[model samples]
Target: MKTNILSLTAIMVVSLQGFSSALETDAPETITSMGQIAEIAHATQEFFWQLVPPMDDPLYIHPDGIVRAVDWKKFKNKDFTSQMTAEMKTVSSSMYPVYRLTVIETRTGELLWHNSLDQLVWQTPAPLDYNPYFFAFEHWNVDSTEALDTQNLLWGRSSNVGAEILLLPEAFMESYEEDVALEAEAAALAAPMAMMLLSPPTVTNLMLAIGVESNEVEVGVYFPSGYTNPVDVFVCSSLMDWDWSLFTNVSSVGISEFTWIDETATNSSSHFWVAA
Candidate 1:
């Protein structure tokens, strides 16, 4: 009887151990892939673009047929003309693309003067005085006094012609460093998420965490289950800013998990996690 009792006790312990091991083996957590992180990054960018405003501004035109305002005094002086000529030469040497400046007499619709499309320099028939207003269009350097003179001629002449000035718009202007810096903040946030999509299939789960305080920023990922080995993570950030548009600072986190299981057990509870 004693022997039978001891045997039954040993059998019960063995059965309990087997049951516990079976329960552990029955449920396995799944690993996440890098592709999922990329999808999230793309979606976030699309959302940001849609939320931003258009970058272009309205054209500046005078009541008369001039595209810009002109200052006659600067054009009339010999010293001013010489300085402007030298500046124009420097601008030409820069190999910048030429823009046409068209001066038209609105009353007769006749072209009065045209400058080289390759060179913005203009030899005015005479130093401009307040009279005989004219309208003009040209690609003028934003930094050049000569360009300012051209713009002034257009504006001053338009005032005389009593015609409205019209200007063609450009798609993009100059980039601002400050704007780029701000945009970089957002890009840095999104890049990690994008990097996740570059991983292989061994990953089954991933998690991302981002935090920022004052000037300090932190990013982390958690891999609680599925992956048997440590995975690599990459992060990147770039700054870009343009004169016409605004960008929001964005931050993102990405994670990837990996696992190994038999093909036949793929659909079984052993291959995935279950929440209570």
Candidate 2:
């Protein structure tokens, strides 16, 4: 009886060990792939583009047809989180440091979105950090059709912190509307229409302080940089029907400054002026 009991105990112990070995053989993997990280980065960009309104939306427009300044916020949430198995962004470290990104809208100059990922174990070696990058903007084409600057992908890095970035709007103007406002103001002042006299305003070669109407186009003449003398101006219109001779309100605000409305040059697309 004693022998039989010992034999049964031994069999039970062997059975339990075998079952544990089977479980170990069927264990699930915990590692992630580099491709998976890239995919997540891609998805993050698409997700971000959906949050903001288009560039031409009236919210961004000012009364003067320039873009207004506004703050950026996520559509549904103030903050967001994502998980990615990214590779090491740094060259020396084999350890992949997950990055936190603060995305700014270049058009509005607002911090619109932010996201970060926590590190994960990998089965296969992952290459390159898969952080999100997004870029968006409006395209101004000579024609009415929409344009795209698809040459480069959106990316940013601090090198020190290993942070990356994403741009939104898919297209960007060379300058923001606010930037345009400042540029237009400066251009109008420097233009020939703003000249007060044909000579330097001051011995220090001061900039002329004459008034410049934003609506009028100033003809450009090749004069010395400090010279402010007025030069003859000529105008052109893209519209074949525009008649410059019919304008009767030719007027001057300064000694040689002159401005006239080419009534037929109604749209910006049709009006162009230069020195005669």
Candidate 3:
């Protein structure tokens, strides 16, 4: 009877492992550059179906249920732009899913801030419901014609760390919250607190070396004296009960002009870069 039970347990374990493997999407050979990343974004055919707004000729209700008139001819058979767009892209490997966050200045086409996540998904079969991070890049100058600063809050599941933990060193932790002062003027300044989770060893290690606490859910990360206010500080994940009104303490001085874009969700479509 003992032998029979042991055999059954071993079989079940193998079956579960196989099932997990089946769920993984293999990573492409390379996904390391902006153009490559953009190609992946373009490859997502479903998103481009909207195309240019129909020419004014026919009448149709938009997906929003608004009545509209347009020429369907202008839209029909319209080829998708082979060129890359400044949008986020997602791809996965056998072990983990990767995310590419990109920011570009529309007027100058200057790449301001770009970051990628390749191995951060510590848990097997990466979490499916990661929330979108709030990015405020290029908010440095009022006209956005000068230098740029980036603040990206990435959220993902990690087997080695707890979710919503700040992982900054002890000294940094004490002053972390003071650096990021939310501007009151940006009426839409409110963002979801759930997006601040950080769990990479590299980020935590640097924080520890700089003298901050290792692993605790953090409200924000503060920069030392030399860095400028607003642009200098970056907020990590915050608690659910955090006070939104506290943003009034500091002002962005009208430098808060940026947008937050969510990365593309995963789909079965083959994710590969197509040259422009």
Alpha-carbon RMSD, each predicted model: 32.0, 29.7, 25.9
Error of 3 at 161 (Å): 32
Task: State the lDDT of candidate 3 residue by residue for 199-249, as single tens digits.
Answer: 223211211111112222222232333433443212212222221122113
Model 3: lowest-lDDT 10 consecutive positions:
4-13
Give the C-alpha lDDT of model 3: 0.21
Q: What's the CA error at residue 197 for candidate 1, in Å?
A: 18
Better of 1 and 2 by lDDT: 2
lDDT of 3 at 8: 10
- Which one wins by lDDT: 2 or 3? 2
Ranked by lDDT, top first: 2, 1, 3
Any runs in candidate 2 off by more than 4 Å, and if so which? 1-230, 239-256
Q: How much is the lDDT of residue 138 in candidate 2?
A: 22
lDDT by residue for model 2 over 14-76, one digit each (tens)?
110111111011112211333323333334444333222222221110011111121123222
Instruction: Write the residue-wise lDDT of candidate 1 on 15-77 in tens digits.
Output: 101111110111121112212222332233222221122212111111122122222233344
Superior candidate under TM-score, 1 versus 2: 2
